[model samples]
Target: MAESQLLCMEDGLMPTAVPESRPQFYYSEQHRAALERLITGGDGAFKSLLKDENGQDFLSAREITAITSSFVKYKTDEENGGASAGQDKRDDAGSLHSTYWPQMSDTEVPPLDIGWPSSGLFKGVTRVAVHTHPPKDNGPHIKEVVRKLIQESSKVVAIVMDLLTDLQILRDLFEASKRGVPIYIVLDEPGAPHFLDMCNRLQVGARDLQNIRTRTVKGIGLNLSVGRIPGNVQSKYMLIDGDKVMFGTYSFSWSSSRMDRNMITVMSGQVVDFYDNDFRELYAISDKLDLFKQFHMTKPQTGTLSRAAVPKRPAAATSRFQVNLGDVTRGDGKVPAHKYHNPKYLLALGQIPGPTEPLQDFFNKMEPPDPETEQELENPTEELENLTPDPSPPEKKKSKKLKLSFKSKRGKKDKKSDEVIEENPANPSDEASKHTLTRDETQDSLKKKNTECMCVIA
Candidate 1:
């Protein structure tokens, strides 16, 4: 019975009255003993295990997964220029990876042992947990770990991540920062826009950034990386309170954990010493991120610009135009002005260019209409042909008056000066030049006009 205890049996051996009638065998112990010998007995042991019962051994899912992970880690190490780290510790970075080795951060860690100096891997593992996520799931397991780490942190918190836009994780960090624990964060420079926007959405004030210091890092990890992009920070690890380290492929952003497979390992021991030092070096080499200066955030402008100098269009004309549009179809068959009849309104609305001026000055830089060809502002339908003209366009010279809507070199003129151009037809180009508007002047005039129009309608 004592020997049988070694086996992981869900159900115990059956009790029997004739215990000594037949010999009892603990086959599990024998199998365990044989497997232990095979692992310790060198290459010859594996040869025997591989050729069992006239058959060849085949790799399981676990073996295939391990091989895939190994290849991925190997490629990542090569990119960081620490590919030989597993072979020789003295050659380059032993385990930690960096662009500037040794100086960037000391690659040396506590020597591997069975006690406290188990080289940051584990010491009795204090606590061990494993989690897996399927496609299209939140994968809240790793998130809970990080939230708890920040919540329980006392001394300091440092995070070096490629991206850090997780709302829940950022809120946890905000709370930790409020508790007066100095939080140091390093993110990729390429993700600055999203990081700043995240802070703003969380209502994190600019002044609060003083407690939660941040920096952005760019460029490939090593100089020898030929085709690597210069926009990624790539490293993902966190050192908490100087004793615990949580490091893995788990991203605190929109990808990885939730949308793909990732792993996070948390360990507490003297192991965190190397990561703490590494974080300090990463922080030193990175550039400071000022939310205010980086995003150009400021108080939104309040008041509108002064429109005293802008000539206001007639308010009565607006009312008349609305009455025509509102009651045209309802009452005794009234009609709004046709598009062709009002050249000034068409010019302002960008339907057509005026004879004296191109609309590129006032509108969205539309090319001027051909001077010889007349632009049809609207389709000439049966009803449109009957609509009368608005007062915006010029009337016949023999009528009551010719309105000069633009300012003149002679200053503000009464009705008498309005007919000066039509009565004295000296130089049409020279007369038109007096009223020609610069782009800036036209924009200002339109802005003021649009403001009043929007107020009355909106």
Candidate 2:
């Protein structure tokens, strides 16, 4: 199921002779067993990822909203002294429970209604927070709401990153740690090549602050998928301390802060315990450990400054439009064939390297024909026909329009027309003379020998 998380560059559009080889990756059985055991045992670490029994390692957007709202509601209720039991609960009951306590002792108390509330679970959570450093100043309400959690308690401060450095945020977090406040940093994985330099820079910051716990994303599997069915799944998220997490399109950098529109949600408590475990697992294999420890001592790689600045425009976001086997087979469990209809994406697939091709360069090489150059290549068919010989006649039925001569009119005029005339001349007298004359003489001869006219055009 974890294998389904791979991004399939092959959409079954390429020729059948060449099969696209998927990226080879190995999953740690130890990790899988650990995850399963943790969840089954109701360990706090299990909740960090917010996955189901199927191992789908993501919470939907609605789930995120619900979880944050649950924390908010619980905190609000706690403030009003109605966190658990209300004194007015008996008012709604028609029967007087106080007098019926003796009868209730003999009877079961309706088993306490073990159903999940529409409001969802709201226990073991004290605050909600959100943070982002998007390219724009939009989504202020989300930021403010998350900040409210911080103002409510000194122990809990939901840091919503409006416009700040990710490294600086971590530095401040280290300060908060000394003061005994738990902090978490959430940001996207810097996957694209364009962001590698920025990441290298932030990693320098990670190196500077030895006191603070810092991690840079090494890899994300989204590997919580079911079986080996490749499909479009999650790609962006980071959780800090189970309580402070960020999930969205933005990454941890100046570009993500100033150029991309993004969102983050922070909810603390058991939820953090759940999300934090998933994060720590991925972070363990990442280079961030080295980066955070080294800080300013390390300079950007040789090409970081030499390369051109990344354009401020958001990269063209791509979406996968997968054709599900289930839909075509109708629960038959057969792998249904699908066509890659998107021309742009299909072209991208062709460029990706399999075992034979380096996938990254293949995609990068995909170029759309320039409209101007395409127009220049367009020439009329008549011009081409005039330049080359006509197609050979069909053996069964030859074309009536087939030309007998390859040369132009002037070149073939005398020999071909004269030969035709020799075979079937308009006048026998003109044939006998054979010698051509000037205009008047030719006119007189033509008038004298005007028996018939057999010009091809006529």
Best candidate, lDDT: 1
The model with the greatest TM-score is: 1
lDDT of 1 by residue, 148-190 (tens): 8899988777889877899888888888767777777888887
**TM-score of each predicted structure versus truth:** 0.35, 0.26
Residue 138 local lDDT, model 2: 56
Tens-place lDDT digits, model 2, residues 351-410: 321234344555476666444323431235522333333456466232222232233334
The segments of candidate 1 whose C-alpha lies over 4 angstroms from its true place after superposition are: 1-129, 134-140, 221-231, 295-458
Candidate 2: where are CA atoms >4 Å away? 1-171, 177-208, 220-246, 268-270, 285-288, 296-458
Q: Which residue pairs show collisions in model 1?
A: none
Error of 2 at 416 (Å): 99
